[model samples]
Target chain A: MVLQILFIAIALAGVALFSYNLKKVIRNIRIGKAANRTDQPQKRMMTMVKVALGQTKMFFRPIPAFLHLIVYAGFVIINIEVLEIMIDGIFGTHRVFGGLGALYNFLIASFEILALGVWLGCAIFLVRRNIIKLKRFSGVEMTSWPRSDANYILITEILLMTAFLLMNAADAKLQAMGAAHYTAVGSFPVSQFLMNLLPNTEGALIAIERGCWWFHIIGIFGFLNYLPYSKHFHIMFAFPNTYFSNLEPKGEFSNMQSVTNEVKAMLDTSFTPPEPDGSKFGAKDVNDLTWVNLMNAYTCTECGRCTSVCPANITGKLLSPRKIMMDTRDRLEEVGKNIDKTGNGFDDGKSLIDTYISREEIWACTSCNACTQACPINIDPLAIITELRRYAVMEESQAPASINTMLGNIENNGAPWKYSPADRLNWAKES
Target chain B: MSEQLNFEVPTMAELLAKGEEPEILFWVGCAGSYDERAQKTTRDICKILHHVGMKYAVLGTEESCTGDPAKRAGNEFLFQMQAMTNIEVLNAYNIKKIVTGCPHCFNTIKNEYPGLGGTYEVIHHTQLIQDLINDGKLKAEGGESFKGKKITYHDPCYLGRGNGVYEAPRKALEVLDAQLVEMKRCKSNGLCCGAGGAQMFKEPEKGNKDINIERIEEALETQPEVIAASCPFCMTMLRDGVKLKDQDQNVQVLDIAEITARANGL
Candidate 1:
């Protein structure tokens, strides 16, 4: 019955991984199309490979990068151990190729080494996120963490990996008494020394080894299936998302979606902007934003580089580009839960200025490209901002009275100043 | 706004009847036309123009805002319209060469307007002064005019970051025998004067700290007596900031044009 259950569990885990990865791939395809990536296909592909395989931008802090590198390496190589466990669990055998086989013993030993490495890296990651105030983790307006999900995710990974390591140490003692020289299990000095205290030796040690293997396999599978619902979703999202990053030049504007006849029918006949009592032309909520932009709010790593370099934020203005991404993130998570239940998000279509972001925030941007440039991830807050401005100016006619007055004068006078066009070269003539 | 400051520049009739590469079309700019003190530099530059025997033309009451303010304030329509008019005026004159005292006008004509098809060979007057000094057409008169005063330059966006022209103004000041102090942020990262986007022509925004105010404070940190600048807008904003911050008790805002021209004794 135990063997039967193990096979069923392993089969279920494989199906879950396949399904989740496929869904993630589909979403990435949509994002790549939406960004209108027209750059050289080869260059983008090369960048994706380097960033994905290398975690290049992850090294902004070398410590985190170094720590993550060990775990990442272990995660890739330890797949052999997982496959061995799955085979052993399904067939009720200690080793499919026999414990005497060199390859099988090597893999078992390799996984123990990796488990130790992963434990060390995960402990540092937990400490860095928790005990230290990195400025990246400090929530604005609140002293405590605003989003607890990543914190919880980290804690859970730490607990599970630590327990898995303990399980390995326990197994190493049990395995060393047996004939198989599972490199780590047989060679570990402390475990080998500990194994001598047991009198019943052979039979009892084999039973202990078998039980520990089951625990290790189950813990790993549980973590794998739980990943899509956790903050570790970045593992799946980051690579493709990096590849599909907004390829539009820093200077070019994202073109407005052409209002189709279908969209016209969706609107009221008056063409007046949606009021508090009516649906807005702007996003009344998160659903109104472009889908990939909505994805960005969730995918944000919450690095404060955008806030640090914002021209508006620097000039003592209230607009924090980091906060802008955070705000959308908070809203989407809130509304996303509701959408799953009731099929609703931003139904009112109110402008972003009116509903989500304030008008004072909208006018504060210097269009300096500093915020977009500073962001480690390719989240273009400025592009989203200017798109909102384009809608307000051209479609909704909701630009601030001050900015519009300048626009009006320029529209009328050919210069923001009240000078005559014929006198353009007046300064050039020496009087 | 001061209508009394207009001047009569002797137009070079001979330069207009020229080959493709003429010597110079001295762009006096609105500030030079209106500010009485700025005229000192205007006259000195004109003398430099005359010294080279370079036939130079003037646009006499034909110059206006280069729409630098318009583009800065997100007023693209006004900027483009000005571009077209400027192109028409230049085409009519058959003018091929240019020099200007206004960095705003220099940036607009050379960078912004050309992108809209009003391309011209534009240079700031300080640049031309530096070039003339190099060619021995202009003299490096040191002691008397500068009077051992320390100077710090406020780089206007239109001149510095807008076009990456940093060296000429510093060279002009150095040659004219003034000490140069670097502001905390200068050149590419130079702060705005609370005035780039037509803000120079208008009242201040409700910023927690005015941009010009912040910039002036950084310049004051250098403890220079004179805040020398190359652009009219920077002159206006930095001067206002100095006054607002009460640093005018120790500092004075002067243009490179005024400084170089006074030192040159033109």
Candidate 2:
């Protein structure tokens, strides 16, 4: 009984710690150096429900998507049981599914089957990422990703799910043996059979079950805690990524809102121009962005959907929508660490774009919203691309030579063509 | 090239009472009043307005440019100033309706100008022309004689994607007995005339594909005798492309108004 109470106390402490860290990480992502969204909600909700759950976009390439879908759906259904396991397994009750005992047994049996399928699906993903070295994942780095990153990502996933399954197997054996003193796992068939193997060995079964339960909970929770700290934080990032989709009409550019202009109007009239000490117009780090854009950085599952459809990326430009997300993630970590150490924020001033995205990479985008449309979780790449363009044009006086020429023409002739405004009417008389 | 021409002007009251008080502000954009061959297209549009007896008012010099170029080139302030100037003029005349010959002006007035509180029903001149012809109020000549000569329509950016005026030009062409050979990139996918986004003012960016010339080549591919466009900017760019490619020996860039005028016996 004392052991059960102690286990509950530890679990409670861990949960609290996890929740606090999550809140902090989330805060850093949201208000960080991203641009303001101007997103449509109704369409976003439809897309989120359809793509995120229905896995519709995956059908664009069936095999890999189907494999991943298995894992995704398994995760969703298994989460309910995972919660129950955390409760009864830790507190030594073993009563969660006992009321409709047969139904409970069937649920566990089917879940175990799904888990195995998920494991196999993840393995296929591992092979594809490592062996195929898909071009979509290769952003403007001008070279392919090293094999180790893919392998590591694959191995990590394998470890996490394997530990979970093993932990389940260990506890189920204890339950099957009807051991009174140990944690009972809810994983089926094997646990039931193994428990019978040690029916008279309840002493042994109890010790093994307790060990397994702790490992399963600790390992999975540790991975959870590590998610925001890693590249695979897509596990947590997909939530806000879907929420902050562009509200503006699809294929239409955002009506550029000069927040600085608004702020100046509201602030002191003497508010000096060229605010060398003001909040950045575009993201320089994760913290300089809005909560949604920052969440995009964390949410990028590295699926490469955005990069694949990008005309600029396909035409050999240096812009990759995928890399933008990754770069945002990298900058967030760097800037977050700085804030932790010095407590200095963006208001005191810092270079934004150079710290976050490369100057050349910014000019390559054509502002296509394909990324948002193709995203399973409604990530908006075009918005980020435009924000960078805005910064480059407004703050840095750096725009494509073509854009500059176009601007000059507009200034001189009130048109993009070089013909004198006088000649503009020369065509009207000949018919 | 220069021309010796005889033209007639309709009185302001006659033009205004044709539609109603600002029901249609017959916007004579710069191209309509001044472009060499395109002026006939403009005059043709005016005669159609006269024949249809639609109540409309000419914006005259008050409607010179919608500042589409400035807005597209990232100079919103100038664009806004232009909008303010034009909107004030339109508002003063109680002009809540606009009919335009220029696609750029149409897009700017109908779409972009609304951001600055200028909102009204604006129809492209092609639409007006199509309506007049469809109603049998306007008549045309020489379509059978020109039947063997292939022609194609080029979509001006401001007319198509920049706004959403796609059908009227085609409808106008159909009434004129002109065959429209569609380029690979037509309608919403129409290539820029190497003129929008302020390309009209400066040299085009060095690209493997000069969008205007590329579009012209598409017209050439169809062996069209002329490239039909409603907007003056498209007309000018296409003309420049024809000249650049020396395709004017066979192909020509003609405004929608001109084609309709030919069919209307103006």
Candidate 3:
């Protein structure tokens, strides 16, 4: 009874801490401007199912994709076992669902099989990351904690899965020996093999079982808390991220409504336009962007698939789509921290445009939609790049000289050239 | 040869004054109206229109830019100004079923103009030619020059990826007895010509190689006698790249309209 109370206390504490951290991150993401992505719930939900749940985009590269699929399925399905763990902990009972008989046996067997797959998947991923040193994984942006974070998660997962199997094996052995609290219930097809190695002592068996059980649960709690700080946050955010992805035509740039309104007022003279809203033209800071943009930054997997397929990056330009997303997320986190330290109206005096993402990087983008297409989670890095460019040109008027000249030509000649409108038809004689 | 084909191309103002509504408005975009090489495409399209006897008129001096380059260059004010002016002229003429040789213009007018209340069914010239041939209104002469030539079609980024047009230009190429080759990256995965997003108006930033040179190198891999393009920007970039490699003399850079014009003995 004392043990049951202790287990419940620990579980509740872990969940409370996790929930607190999650709420803070959610508040941070909401600090950005309003956006209306509430339309087309059916389509959005369908996209979530296909892209996030079904792992549709991940299957582009067969080998890694297959391994990722195994790991992903294992991680999701193992949570069902965590539910049983919670129940068993709260009631202080061994095999709490053991009353279901054959059904309980099937569930245990399935969990064991999935745990084995996850173990193998993590092993292969470690080899691919540390040994093979995949180019995308080891890029300049991935040099420090990014690399370490990925390794840490994989190692943690391996340990947790190992602990789970060990606990199941020890419990099975104790049950076979007619131990007191250890019921002869459930199956362990894979872990049952490990029971032969354990000593046939009730005290030692209970210690092993309890140690593995505590380690597994504690590791899960640690992982739950680590998500907001790591790129692995995609595990939780990918579904909602894909759900809120841009459904418009890929090449269509969203028009600035203020400019559109001004043009409409000018064209239709009877309609009186309101004065300027005193808002900046485009995104110069994190707060200028829509909440969905902030969500996109937080959901980035940092997998560099977008960067790998980017023409600008492939051609050795300054732009890297992955870096753009990373910079946005970093700046957002910094802003969140500033607000936390000070009040909600705190000013960091550090903007995302020149402070973190340089003009050279912004200008190098080809706007080919390749990066967006390549993202596994449907993150649109190009939208962020375009928005920043909009801020640079429209807000600050700091566009490159050639772009300024082009804009001038458009203003004068109604085209991208310096030729007079009267001379527009001169090329007809050549035909 | 020019004296034999003197079709009277009327302006929208003239057509409107004559109390007539043409079947289509030929949006002779900036490139078609001003760029030297693209003017030939404009004329070829006109020649084909004459042959097909389709009632079409251009906006002439009243036509402004499509504001594609301006909008892409991040100057929303100038883009809106240009778009508003163009939309005003089109609405005044009550223009519908427009066609252009430029994908930039096609994409802008077809997609962006609707927001500004200038909506119309816009088609690229290749799509028009494909339809003409499909309807048996136009036919390519069998003994046309460059028959069975190894011709590879470059998918313009705006036309292919931006607007989902991959088959119209290919169908136009198929009208000739030419073998249509493809680059390593074609269709939905086709690389840009280093000219979209107003890159044509500025020199490429420091990189290992210009994107067009890379694209042209891919085209050369197919050993194509003719590099076919549907967008004038792609044509200009690919031609410049071919010239840089000193292969311009060997390989011809022609628009689909030009190819179709030649096939029809225009």
Candidate 4:
């Protein structure tokens, strides 16, 4: 009873801290301005099923996709065993689902096998990152904490999976010895071999079992809380981020409502022109971006797949879609930290543009939609790039001289050229 | 170059003055209106229309740019101004169906114009050519110059990935009776011509290689006798890329309209 109460208290505290951090992340994302993504609930749900649940886009590259599938399936299937552990911890029961007899054994055996698969998957991923040296994993922005964070997550998963098997192995040994409070009800298909390594004494068995149990559960709680600060948050946010993804044609640009209303007023001859809205034309900071854009930033996996297929990035341009997403998320974290330290509306001198993302990167994009299409989770880095470029031209008036000349020509000649509209048909004459 | 072309192109104003509404409005985009090389495509499309006996009229001096470059360059104010003027002109003519030889104009008129209250049935000239061939109105008979030639089609980003019209161009190419070759990257996975998003108006940023050069190298890998494209922007980019390799005399870069016009002995 005492052990059960202790476990309950520790679990409650961990969950409380996790909930607090999650709420803070949500609040920070909601700090972005509102945009209507609720118009197509049915289409959004289909997109979530296809991209997130089905893992449809991941299959574009086969080997990593297969390995990721094992990791993903293990992550999902092993959580069923976690539920039973939670119940056993709270109720002071030995293998609480042990009453189901054969069904219980089958579930335990499957969880043990999946735990092994998870361990192997993490081990291979670590090797791929460290030894094989894939080009996508190494980039200018992937240094320091981003690099170490990935390594840490994989190592942590390997450790937790090992701890799970150790606990099951120790328990199986204790059950075979006919010890007090030990249940021989569950099956251990994968961990059965580890029983020989465990000492054949009650004290040793209890200590190993208890230590692995605590470490496994505590490690899970720590990973849960660490997610919001890490790029691994894609495990939770990919579904919702892809669900709210833009469903319009890739080539079509969204017309700004302010620009539309102004144009409408101009077309209306009877109505006089109104004063321009004081609002900035495009995004100058995090607050100007929509909530979905903020969600995209949070859901980035930092895999660099988008950057790999990007024509601009492939041709050695400064523009990297992965870096664009990382900058947005980093700026969002900074803004969130600023608001947390000071009161609600604190001014951070740093803006997303010029400080984190340079104008050179923004102008380098060809808006080819390759990055958007290549993203496994449907995060539209192009959308953010376009908005930032809009700010650079409309708000800062810092476009390149060539672009400025093009814009000037459009404003003067109804075309992007020095020739007048009267000369448009000059080429139509016999040539 | 040996193809004989004959066509009497009428203006929209002339047709409207005669109390007639043509079946389609030919939106000769800025390139078709003023560019020397692109003007040949415009003439080829007109010749094809005459061969098929389809009544189509050009907007002539009344037409202006669709403002694709300005809009892509992030000049929304100028784009909207130009779009509104063109929409007013189009709505005045009561244009029901439109066709263009340029992908940029087709995309703007089909996708962007609807937002500005100028809705019309927009079709690319390649798609129209495909339909005409399918309807038995035009035929690629014995005079097919490209028959059995190794011809590969370069999918323009605007037509293929941006708009999902990949099959129409391929089907049009199938009419030439040529052995249609494909680059390693085609269709939805097609690379950009490095000219979209207003990149044509400015020089590319510091890079190891030009995107057009990379893309043209992929086309060259197929060892095609002719590299075909349907966009004026793509035509220019690939032509320059072919020239950079000094293969202009050996390998030809021609638009679909030019090929179709010659195949029909226009």
TM-score of each: 0.65, 0.69, 0.94, 0.96
**Residue A249 lDDT (model 4):** 78
DockQ scores of the candidates:
0.15, 0.15, 0.57, 0.66
The residue-by-residue lDDT of candidate 2 on B100-122, one tens digit each, is 87876776687666755678888
lDDT of 4 by residue, A88-200 (tens): 88987768888899999999899899889889998999999999979999887898999999999999999999999999999999999988888688899999999999898
Per residue, candidate 4 scores C-alpha lDDT tens digits across B1-266 of 43334446889999999999999999999888777788889888988898788998999889988988888877777788889899999999999999998998888889998988899999999999989988988888645578899998998877887788998888888978899999877887788888888898899999899999999999999999999999998999999999999999889999999888878877
Clashing pairs in 3: none
Q: What tens digits encode model 1's per-residue C-alpha lDDT throughout B145-204?
A: 675678898877666655667788888788766678898767655666655534555444
Top model number, lDDT: 4
Comparison by TM-score, 1 against 2, better one: 2
lDDT of each: 0.60, 0.63, 0.86, 0.87
Which should have the higher DockQ, number 1 or number 3?
3
lDDT tens string, model 2, A225-322?
Answer: 66655656665556555555655434333343454344343443675545344665444445545667767777777778777765445445566787
Error of 1 at A307 (Å): 0.7
What CAPRI-style quality would you assign to candidate 2? incorrect
lDDT at residue A257 of model 4 (Cα atoms): 71
State fnat for each of the candidate structures. Answer: 0.15, 0.09, 0.52, 0.60
Give the local distance difference test score of model 3.
Answer: 0.86
- Stretches of candidate 4 exceeding 4 Å from the true structure: A272-277, A344-346, B1-5
